[model samples]
Target: MITIILICIGVLFNIFGCVGLIRLPDVYNRLQAATKCVTLGCCSILLGVVFHYGLSDAGFKALFAIPILFFSATVAAHALIRGAYHFGTKLGEKSVKDDYKEVVK
Candidate 1:
């Protein structure tokens, strides 16, 4: 039962992430959506795997992947956003503020 719920949640998160990728306005926003969604969705899936498999090696592997996915996604998103900022990919005109503008200038 718990495994089923986790899998459902993971699937929904992934779907929402995909929607975010399509709906977000700029590269930075898209990266944020993709990173957060994928990491969270994958983490849930991995947790489901751990639940289903118990203390088996595969379960352990899935458990280990959760942290790795979280950290890697965060770092990768930050790096991409930084790169986009450096390259001057203009934010959508609807953007209300530019937090990095002063730093980049």
Candidate 2:
């Protein structure tokens, strides 16, 4: 029951992430959406696996994978966004402010 609910939530988040990737105006926004939604989705799916499997081998693996997935996804997304900014990717027209501009100068 709970496992099904978690899996459904995960699926919804993943769908939202995909939509964000297609709908967002700029690379940064897309990256933010992809990173946050996908990470949460994956983690939720893994949590469901853990719940479904209890203390079995699959559950143990999911337990170990959760933190690793979270941290790595966040770090990877930050690195990609930073790299894109350094490489001269422009912000979208709707973007209000760049917090990094003064820092880069």
**TM accuracy, model 1:** 0.93
By lDDT, the best candidate is 2
Q: For each candidate, give its TM-score against the true structure.
A: 0.93, 0.93
Q: Give the poorly placed runs of model 1, Cα more than 4 Å off.
A: none
Error of 2 at 20 (Å): 0.6
The count of backbone overlaps in candidate 1 is 0
- Candidate 1 residue-wise lDDT, 4-105, digit = tens: 999999999999999999998888788878988878989999999999999999999999998888888888888998989899899987889887788787
- Provide the overall lDDT of each model, using Cα atoms, as 2-decimal numbers: 0.90, 0.94
TM-score attained by model 2: 0.93
Query: Which residue runs of candidate 2 sit more than 4 Å off their true CA positions?
Result: none
Error of 1 at 55 (Å): 0.8
Question: Looking at model 1, which ten-residue stretch has the lowest summed lDDT?
Answer: 96-105
Worst 10 residues of 2 by lDDT: 96-105
